[model samples]
Target: MSTIDHPNTEATSAEARVTSDPVLVSDVVRSDRLLLADNTVKNHVIAATGVSLVPVPLLDLAAIMGIQVDLMHELCKLYDVPFKEKLVRSLLTSLAGAAGTVVAMATLTSLAKTVPMLGSVAGAAGLSATAAAVTYATGRVFIQHFEGGGSLSDFDPVQFKELFKAKIKEGAQVVKSFKPKSTTNTDQTAQTV
Candidate 1:
């Protein structure tokens, strides 16, 4: 048997071999839109002050949080970072306070729906705002970490908590300033018939 020698195949580590892919701003924007839409719908329902509908939006908020976590993973993949599925658990543990608040709000919303007079209250708006803030904070943290040459395995949730909170406050302002899309007047359009 003739043996041919391969040069330095074992020298390169997997981490060193992985190269960054192009992560576009547009992709992030699209993901943000998804998060926003989820928040908006829940907010709108809550704002309607309908009792039976409260639970529906609260349930949706939980689902959206899951989606947000998935989005972080997706963003990590786009930035060529090693996707660590376990990181999600670590993130939740580190941000337990924030995550717990969201859960509490969801629980409250659910309870409000079952109560007689409480269903008509306008507390859902607060929950909606929280949803938006958390989504924004989560995305910002992941993006900053990925951009700083950190991968999922290197992510330290405790170290990033303060930064995440700052981002959450900023994101809350953004959510406050958010304006819905305006409708265009179609009557002025030229007809091709």
Candidate 2:
């Protein structure tokens, strides 16, 4: 019996064998969006409030990456789409843009009819501002969705119970941090009564 050299195995000296791990590659690709969302949220929060909920004293990759990865994975499960994050983000971007444009156009048209001199300028500026605002708002919403986990509505409570619970928890934590520490040391020599 003669054995032929398989390309998948060690081939002739003329060729270099190329190999790949599809699972690992897909995993990394999937993880990247999650990582991006995490960094975006962290950066935005840090810029806005200077507060971070990340576990480490420093905002490192593991905490940020883990939260986003878990969130994305969970969202994928909850959503019916095969690739949830991308689909959801794209939809959000488009919807936000459309809504912004409509509102801007309507407001501008109304103002233009009422104000004679500012008509043309208002229309142009309104469209431009609408485009910019939509992009910014959609990006913000995307980051917020990932950071909040599940949905933006998850952070936005429609019912009072959830809001009240969150407020109570926040208050309790604040009160815990503010509790007074008693000093036990008593010096009689300093009493000059």
Candidate 3:
């Protein structure tokens, strides 16, 4: 039997070492984007009503999820992992539970809208808060998974459910901490006037 020449073990080991390291991206930028998306969803959830409200959170969530997927794609490229569009789409679709949460929020908001005063009093605040929490959880999940060298194939939503629930509580705190820009602007205007 003819023997084939093997490549240098040292070269293979060096390549493995280089590839194993985590890719460095700007966490600040990522966090800012995630926050912006969460705020946008919150705003939309607050402003929308009736049938219009049903889709707003879902749409915003989809947009934010898209951005997160793009961020993941960049990380995958840097980490020398495969990043296929199909895989990204599959991962996004697998987040149906989050979408279902948004839908539930929308349904509640719609029912609340049927009542005259309850729409503004209960639905807006409650649904918007839920929207913020859900958005935050989604962003956090993607960040944690991608940062931990997880790929689309490696993702398991069932395994992440507990972490996502914990993150929702943290997200509520973050949302509570956000001071609306309109309030800040009004304060500045009052000072100037």
Candidate 4:
């Protein structure tokens, strides 16, 4: 009879311990997914800010809606949620109430732009900042839902109403303090080319 040898039981034991704890494994996976999702969210928010800086009230709102819908769609894909355009639009409309404060601010600022000169400058700056903040808040709300294993089908905006408001506050602060990182690599590559 041939004897079978088991090598490195200690290493095997360590591996076994890691596999045995599903919470730890899931946490690591969630962390990685969160990092990727955050990058996706940030890119969408930047797009929203740029589009919202148009200084036209109704027109800016329409542009922001498209950007926000795309943001939610991308988030849904990341979280493996079914993306239904109708439902997304409906849900966004529901969130409009929750985001009323920022929306109202944007509207007023946009109206100011009609006067020209300083008004245009202030309106553009305010719109961009508020636009970024609102997008950030919306992304954070969806992220919290997805993180909790809730899909778009089960997401209740009412449940997250207060949270949405709080996130907006945090987002505004973040946007105000944020300094844009120069695309040095892309800049250098273009120069070389």
Candidate 5:
């Protein structure tokens, strides 16, 4: 058998490798959507980690929540699901409530910032990780739901409880892999987007 050198190279892509086969085309499109969704999740998770550094008790968590909501809204757009802010918020609360310990840890981490001097440091340390994990898991579960033809209107947080917990563990590793982006670049990217 003969093999091409550097088979791992991007010389062959999902679309390029396949003919006009409907099944293969659908697979390529699905694969592309997944990559896009993953990118969107990573960007928002990084932003949430930054927001966790806001240094104010509860305020940081509040900011992180807003970021999570925005992440969900973007995912909704990507999946062509109805984007209802109020419904999303309710769904988020349900998710967080199901996250129980993760949510509690995040709250405790945020509250730790109330200390006179060391509070900021402690909160920043804990909240950043917690926020990244929670945000990432949220994005991931949403992506899975959308991929399975589920919409936000029928999303059940209870059904995803175990998966959400597992994803939080996965998310911690993902967050550590992300390097912080510079403010100038972030600002420019935001403006362009």
Candidate 6:
């Protein structure tokens, strides 16, 4: 009787782990470049907008849905819950507010150059109205998207509300406990009073 010997995969995997250089420099370099690019864009926006640089929330919604703790940790490192909420609100507001001005100027400029026969005022007004409609539609869509996320209306609204209330109560307690040291002059004034 002849017996066929199969190679053991587990032993091979164990042997491979010892020799593998897990730290890949190319991957590190790429990640560093991405970080640099992100910083550059953030700096440019901050310089132009005069707003503090708020990092984008690092949570992958897909990963969160899959219940990945590592992704949650990564997100916490990038943005806290309150800051993430604030960032979303800020983005929504900015997109809603800026759409009209940008669209109006671009459309008017384009129309004015393309159809010289149409007097500037008429062309500008037509373009401006078109831009306004587009902006309104865009803003509405953005708001709808924001509201669709249901930050307030959810399965565990009661629990979340209680948690929020508890946090506020805790904060109030902490504030109440904080006592500013009375200076000598303040003590003297108190004594006089």
Q: Which is the winner by TM-score between candidate 2 and candidate 6? A: 2
Q: Which lDDT tens digits does candidate 1 get at residues 1-193?
A: 2223644454445435564465689788657754654454335323322222345645655455565666665666566667665677567546646456655764565555444555634345555666666666777777777666687777787788788778778867777677575655664354432
In model 3, the number of clashes is: 0
TM-score of candidate 1 versus the correct structure, residues matched by position = 0.56
**Number of the top-ranking candidate, with lDDT as the measure:** 5
Candidate 2 local lDDT, 148-193, one digit each (tens)? 4444334332322233333333433433443476654454435633
lDDT of 5 by residue, 85-116 (tens): 99999988899889799989999988988886
**lDDT of model 4, residue 146:** 92
Question: In order, what lDDT does every prediction score?
Answer: 0.59, 0.39, 0.59, 0.83, 0.88, 0.35
Segments of candidate 3 deviating more than 4 angstroms: 1-106, 180-193
Q: Model 6: clashing residue pairs?
A: none
Candidate of highest TM-score: 5
Candidates in order, TM-scores: namely: 0.56, 0.28, 0.48, 0.78, 0.80, 0.22
Better of 4 and 5 by lDDT: 5
> Per-residue CA lDDT of candidate 3, range 132-187, in tens?
56556666676677667676688897788778877777867877777455558788
Q: Report the candidate with higher TM-score, 4 versus 6.
A: 4
Model 6: per-residue Cα lDDT over 105-190, one tens digit each: 43444345344444444444443333323322322232232233433122132333333334333433433343366579888989
All-Cα superposition RMSD per candidate: 12.7, 19.0, 12.7, 6.7, 11.2, 21.0
TM-score for candidate 4 = 0.78
State which candidate, 1 or 6, has the greater lDDT: 1
TM-score-based ranking: 5, 4, 1, 3, 2, 6
lDDT of 5 at 79: 90
Which residue pairs in candidate 5 collide?
A: none
